[model samples]
Target chain A: AVAMPAIAQSMPEVKWRMTSSFPKSLDTIFGAAEVFAKAVSEATDGKFQIQVFAAGELVPGLQALDAVQNGTVEMCHSASYYYVGKDPTYALGTAVPFGLNARMINAWFYHGGGLEVLNEFYKKSGIYMLPGGNTGTQMGGWFRKEIKTVDDIKGLKMRIAGIAGQVLAKLGAVPQQIAGGDIYPALEKGTIDAAEWVGPYDDEKLGFQKVARYYYYPGFWEGCAALNFFFNDAKWNELPPIYRSVLTSAAARANVDMQASYDAKNPGAVKRLVASGAQLRPFPQEVMEACYKAANEIYEEISATNADFKKIYDHMRAFRNDEYLWFQVAEYTYDNFMIRARARG
Target chain B: AVAMPAIAQSMPEVKWRMTSSFPKSLDTIFGAAEVFAKAVSEATDGKFQIQVFAAGELVPGLQALDAVQNGTVEMCHSASYYYVGKDPTYALGTAVPFGLNARMINAWFYHGGGLEVLNEFYKKSGIYMLPGGNTGTQMGGWFRKEIKTVDDIKGLKMRIAGIAGQVLAKLGAVPQQIAGGDIYPALEKGTIDAAEWVGPYDDEKLGFQKVARYYYYPGFWEGCAALNFFFNDAKWNELPPIYRSVLTSAAARANVDMQASYDAKNPGAVKRLVASGAQLRPFPQEVMEACYKAANEIYEEISATNADFKKIYDHMRAFRNDEYLWFQVAEYTYDNFMIRARARG
Candidate 1:
């Protein structure tokens, strides 16, 4: 049925406090706040406003979970997977190696019980959840040297996150949890041999291309990496129905916008990066296979230890399987034909 | 600095005709097409494939002026704005009068501009176009009802395309020409509301939400409008560069996966709309009067003018200067403040 008729509803003047898990330096991601706040205000005709606070303005970027959960801020924009330490299920909310592409992840969230299951998990942390944005398929990692085999990953420190880090750890890569802004310096200063930012567009802007000559590909870990917007459960429930809807809609829009920005900007940026002498390399196939092997093993381990993680992962895997099975025949056949023909032509 | 990606530059094979005026739908817009296509091919390991079509697939939609100007696309996904009558610019796109709601317009395009813009415009004379999708914006048709008095609209159909038919004749409304969407529609749709569309998210989606909407003050011209992909240009650049980008990108994404798709499956679609409807709405007292007045004068003149409605009435006057000037301030003020605040926060 439709929402309450406009006449039947008496809108409320609500003020919201949002704590971001990021500094405002990153506009594409931080742009979410600008769009969301502006949208919330416009939707409410300025009657409802969400005063957004930057990561450090309220708390440490990493502390957004506690702040939002504790109601220090009514909401937050972050990578849920970053909190895998608290609940491995969060990785499914974001992405894990070999997971669905950004588009598939969104579909899963909207159609595959992803939002529902992820929300349930957020409730435990005292918040409500929405997928705000995604970094479409990420690059593997920025490396100091060419990776010839799985052995190349041994003991190398990397500023990485999500399940991919663990997968890398199994392959002997020392994973470090660092923020985006911090990655370049850490890498440039030699604190880490490699790091993985997003694709060419962002990587070039961050100047990762300047320092790292051997950039690897197939960010298998994140075909589509999602950013999450977390609203405190209590605060969320307090929103006027319209306000809630606005937040949801805005988040979804921002989700697409973020990725689109990346796509449009990436092509031009890649052209520039190449012009600037960046050396792009593919992750060794063996390394990819090994990472895949390690990833499954880690997924299994987390599932065994955490029921919540196992529960969601099981569902996600099932859907992936069903989806993959269907794609094999129709889409796969045609896309294969097109790619080859286009090249040949 | 660059991906100079040689490994995966491994272009897959395939050929096909796809006409669209959209970027790859990222999880929201055209994301599904991507997921579907990727699943198919990736599942097979380059065995089969489907190509895509983006705007300018073969030719450009607006060039229906150009297509008839040349001969393009077998099919397309475009909104009326691109052509604007071939001459009046009235046919420029679709959905004038308080325009169509995003959903209803979808109904219309599949049903209205659906056949109108194409057969009525693109395909009718020759080429083909279809209603691919829409994002719901449709503020108070923007000329707004708030005019100080009706006399204000003398000779003003305002650049408003499509529905200008009713108002322009009724008042001095003059329609103008502009395009966005690589000619999928007008990237220029924003300031016209003399209106805009999609939603704040997509408005902001297309970067218009930031420019006007009186913050949603008015814009009855386009309530919910559709976007189409135009096609056929010299047998489509003879099926290469553009045709290639399109067939591959469009078949898999574009209009079919655009804002409409996002609006449809977007879980919190309405939620986000309300959140960012952007203080938008019906025009004020005098403003609408001025629009009516101006729209009529322009309509009368055009009704009697050249075989093709000489001198397309470019923009809504009374409020035109005021609106543009208003935006210069609002945009600058709002943008600078927001940008700075975001930076600080």
Candidate 2:
């Protein structure tokens, strides 16, 4: 027999506020938090409601981590890399250059001991993290010129971030970390030669096509960028078991929904971009190869000095190696043939 | 401000029973149902409990859909394709030959209108469906001898089920659908020339490797097989909104956890299978090409007579086409490079 809700009963209604690292205009990203909140509210019979505050509504986007840590906000939907200044390990929780893609990251976190390892790191920060959403593999960036070879990037000035920016700097590119809103103008005024934003869906909204005609893909730096719903430790522990379950499931649903929205919407965006005369390009083999070399070097150097970084990095690398092998044999082979076959038909 | 849960209160208690199409021995498949039940109970603070019954304990495995539909059981966890006898449209809820893989399937269902379309179809059967789990990509199967060309499949006997079996029949192979436990013995006794179960993890447990030396990959027929959780319409609607939300999130979590478990476990299973003298091989390109051709033809023939099948198939086909194109430029390219690089290292 199923449990029926007791009617005419009184229970305390709970409400909370969440600060998002993204503005409402980027619905796909910010919308995941909204989706989580609404589902949680509905699941709790309207007893649990979380009001979402856009970036700068309550605190600047980058400071979301601080807000949650100090209890300025109970929770946040934000990217992990925004707090890399605290520890380089923060970047691994999100995405790293040449790292796992969206599916692989999910596999790692949920199955390959990644969640436990990362949570141990988060425990020190006085918060708990749950996967909020993911943007599937991102595009390389919009460029004003085609990069024909490795040399093309040597003197290039580009806006990139986190470990990726560090990797590019080693390859002789001057990496500028600019705020998202300022990227288009930087590329337009020749202040920067290129700027990497998210993939087609988000990049199109930023008007990158208007300034940069060449669009390179497989942003090796961000194969997949994962966003998290973070809860303060004491507040999280105080919640009833049922509400905790709601939060867990709601966040997981949001995780799947966000990526699906991106995947569904991105194809149309790419089509529109091409129609607008945007050229799609793959980063030249020479450049990809050089970046690959630099990324590994950077990993090796960081692993030498940071114990926590080394610990998680080593585990992730091994897990990633195994994932790549398995996917190549099954997923890759099937996809490669089918894409070509469908095109032929 | 964050609201805390009020203590010293009583809530109603509920219990449920889940009928599963899989036996207890197959933990990964049957275990997902257990996982969902346990999560629900815990989330409800013991106010809800779901006792699980293995196939045949209550009803035969294939009868799971009937049990749920009739309210003989409140819910059931099984593959949608198992009930294809009820309607060919049912197969679309699981997998079809050369169809979307695991990640793409998630995208289609959650965001590409697959869920809405399929749920409408399910409403006729008196149940609501939620994605329960996925076996990422299954292996082609175990072969007693090497298959070098399409011709080798002409007279072979294989134990493969669903639409894939029909496609194999078109290619001149004799198809047999046997219970999982019986396949290994049949393959060993020369009753069947080949047998396809799941991937390495489950296949190894069944000792398929000991009897068959050639293990082929990219089960083109089942690029990914999705299992589903079905709740009886009457019983489902009677639950409180909070309970419904619990089920939604719980099922979603199970959906993700199942795939993660397989992905995490399969690599080790693969290595062990090779150690046991199982020769790993990809199905010859010629065989794959022939199967692909047959699959498309079968879809066309079925679409002509089955309106429900045609409607969903067309949406899925268009969605699959777009997904393949987007994945090619980014996911595929990056994977193609990284896999080779990792192997080389």
Candidate 3:
């Protein structure tokens, strides 16, 4: 039988309010939500229009989870770890210290049964989550002084977050949680000695290089931070199947897009930072070793206390072990050789 | 103004035939096309149903492109590199020796102007292309004997593809382009000494480890192989805006899904292969160095002769260089340290 031709059909104009944890100025982070909304609107032929609000416009940044759960808004775009105060399992939805990297997370979420576990965890909260955005791997942080040993972190006042901050506290450093906007002034005024944002693209925008000279490598705390799109369960179930597929597809695209934006933009930003006299340095092995040890202790402590944390953490750890072995053989070997070879030329 | 509610509306029923280059037995590769079709159908509320035909069911696998271009079918899912015989530029649409990895390709395609260049390249053929799927990094190949030095490659009859085969030939090996199904028999009978398909998931299905004990890793030629969804230009232009958006979103999801499937499945497959007495190994540095040199020379020769190849090659190389540098700092540093630390524990 011949197929019928597609004809113009007026779609129902559904508008949604989406609260983002980020202010609009950080385009790559906040811009992902806008990209997703645009794609959804265009895909549904204006049937689905989501109005995005910067952090404080609808509710406080960290309170987006509350907004989503209470049905204050139909949806929200925020880092899942921001709601770890409610349940530590929420941190796994985003990232945790020494957890999966971007590729591994993608594998776990889409293929290795991560999304199922996470959605199950979210069932108690009356929300459904989708992978929204990723910032590949973040920089360790911007530091005013080089961190050489475990002792160097002692008594150090730094702006960090979540489990990483807790691990840092174990190392005798003072972990202060500060707002994004406030981090720079604190660093500049010596109220804080170090701070980490995302990577070069977003970091350069925050002008972290202006106050910090020693730029550290690899944010082990957040290997790859994922942002999630939270939908009210009732609102989500009420949507037509087509809209649901579009939501998954659009968010998937946004996830790749945000990280790509960071990857493409960061090179130029890093070069500029270096030209402006910022010194790039790998965190000393001693510091990394110390952090790793502290991170394990914190994980053990949390697992011993929190059933939810233990359940998800155990699954994540197992998957990570397999992922690393495979990657070490296929990915790392290729990348290490290629990078060095490319450098030699 | 408050938004109107979505009501069930009668929709257009469009059916198209999609030819895939891969056989259905290799589910991850061929399964991607089915996945895309299913997503498209469900997203359009059963209005858009695509009938997927495996390789040789309708037309030959490699000729899927011709079927799409000639309008014998409205769409076809195949790797663009399969058309390297038509134009070497086609390799850029898929992969090249040491080209962009899965994440880098996603970054380049979605964010770094790869899709623009590729689609512009495809315009001459009256087809539009979308990123369909990827096989993360591939295993180098399976060999009957261990290859420890550059000289070990000489006089070896191996099945490889694209520029990689050409590079292998330069190293004094006879590069045979054997079909996937024929590789096992050829290897079993010793007509071919070695072959490379994809990674462990697909490789296990092909049962290569039974004949070839040494399974080498990090396929240099295809660091990541991408598959594309080709649409007849006229047919693509005929798609409604919403349908077009759905197509983009669906394809993007498929891209992420395929790689994730490979990453998630390969580890277990590799473990099984090892248990079955297959030895896992990396290609030696001497051999890698030789292949890199030969690959560069071939690229130079191609650029000197083919303008299209040169144009995309130059653009891709520039983008790849920047991508590697950024990835080196953020991605590599993080993964390397984590893998080592995780291993120690």
Candidate 4:
């Protein structure tokens, strides 16, 4: 049963701290961490609070996973996908090419049992998990020039996240991992020909369109990139059950807020990007098809080698299949009808 | 800005009869309608889907307030507060007197809210509002509770909801209110003790919970009660939108299944209630003394004017003030430190 104590009032207080891998200026991402921490504090009657710190304050921006992994902090709000350098499997936590969308990922985590399976994997990293946010179906990246074919990907240097970088590498692209704050300078001087951040909201905020005119769609690598709160396993275990529930519930709230933030803010940001000479384009069918094929092959390899990864992947795929079947019949039919009507209107 | 389409996964053509006062359960409330409807349909996807009936299905349950208002069909899941007739305002929602329990209401709404509220209000009338679910904090039923030495009155009937009936009567109390299924019986029932329903959750639900519960608190009226969605609100407004966001969000998922319906299945449902039962008890000697005095003078003047009760009440006090202020600080401190620690352990 869910409990909310009111009027008879008085809630317990909690003080906790968290380190985030993004700057405060990135509202959706960093804002999500802040909101989660604040909600936990308030909801628990301030009995549980998580003080959040921006990247570089607690540790180097890119090393957030390590900080939490080693218990350098009580908790760290960071993207697990960033640590593919340590293990390829880490990328699955954030986003991957041809992966699920934001809503789909949430469904998978909460109801589809992804949380249970993923938590099993997170145990190895010595942290417990809660979804902090999601960058709903990100944009491909800001590119200096258009690519009409798979060959165009060769010799291009791009800053991207996770195994999608590995896929790019396989396609003969050089993948660079850079913290968000530093992406622009590198892109400006041709240090990198392309960089994939999140969607229009964050991309516009980072001034990415100003540097790269050709903006691509379907960030294949991050169909729905999700961020997470990595609680030091020991600290998580020590928390009273209520606090833990608060933490989890708070994460769910942040997850919803992050998606809404992007959805709400992106419509305008996208317009601004287009007005500012950013050429928004869908990846050519050939490119998308090739990438999908490559993704499948890569997935097969990972499944064979990693037992845990295989387990989660199999379960996720099965649920997705069922969901797709239902969605195709209902959501698709309704969406199609509405879109057509909307267009006519 | 959050929008969910009205139609969900299509149903296998079937028939169902759902009774609710709400126009198809509007999100939080409608979620329940959808859950029940969908579950039944899904469980027997091809065969049945209990057709939903909104307020006034047989007769405006609020007016027809059910004890099986109009000899309605099968089920009704709503808050107890809507019907304050057989008793009074306190009987309408759940309980008054510092009441609002997630699980207890789940029990009451499903068991008590439905059984007691419907039975108390409609036993002679023969209509019912099953306990499908509850909206957590119903405004103190617009009250008429009064006090002078906390002993000035002993048999004043009221339109009330839930167990608060027992509590209020304990403090010089008769409580009553009609069921949404058989509300007219109650408004017409001189047998009323007092009535108290929901606030906004109240307004949208039994309409009467809003219309009547208002007629007291801080003393004997509902301090906090869950508003319910009694059916027979005219077979529930056709049910398409109700099935999607409105009813699904309300009934099945209102505030995360509330503390009702599912509470019994919960493992430790009763422990916290018992430990906290003491807290649930009436205002202490000093507190009741001051409040009782204030309530009387306020009630007399409000009745005397027959003018704006809200306006007069507004001048008397803030919606949530001094007592609440203390809660944010010290009360929260004690709760977080000792109370919470003990509750969980």
What lDDT score belongs to each candidate, Candidate 1 first? 0.54, 0.88, 0.88, 0.54
**Each candidate's TM vs. the true structure?**
0.53, 0.96, 0.96, 0.53
- Tell me how each candidate scores on DockQ against the true complex: 0.02, 0.51, 0.56, 0.02
| Residue B91 CA displacement from its true place in model 3, Å | 0.7
Off by over 4 Å in 3: A1-11, B1-11
Q: Residues A119-233, candidate 4, lDDT per residue (tens digit)?
A: 8888987878877777666678899999999999999999975678778887889999787878999999999999988777778888888889998876767657789988889
TM-score (chain B) of candidate 2 = 0.96
Of 1 and 2, which scores higher on lDDT?
Answer: 2
**Clashes per candidate (backbone, < 3 Å):** 153, 0, 0, 150
Model 3 agreement with the true structure over B1-345: per-residue lDDT tens digits: 733323223234678999998899989988888878888887776778899999999999999999999999999999999998998889999999989888888888888888998899999999999999899888898999999999999999999877788999999999999999899999999999999998888889888989998999889888889999999999989877777888888888788888888888988988898999889899999899999999889999999999888988989889888888888987899999988987897
Q: Candidate 2: misplaced stretches above 4 Å?
A: A1-12, B1-12
Model 4: residues >4 Å from true position, as ranges?
Answer: A1-13, B1-345
For residues B66-151, what per-residue lDDT tens digits would candidate 1 score against the true structure? Answer: 53324332444445564554445434345443323332333333322234433444443444453444544433333332344445
Best by DockQ: 3
Better of 2 and 4 by DockQ: 2
Considering summed lDDT, which 10 consecutive residues are worst modelled in model 4 chain A? A329-338
The regions of model 1 sitting more than 4 angstroms off are A1-9, A328-345, B1-345
Q: For model 4, how does the per-residue alpha-carbon lDDT over B34-110 read when each residue is reduced to its tens digit?
A: 55565444322223456656656644545424533553554454545445344443243454333323322333333
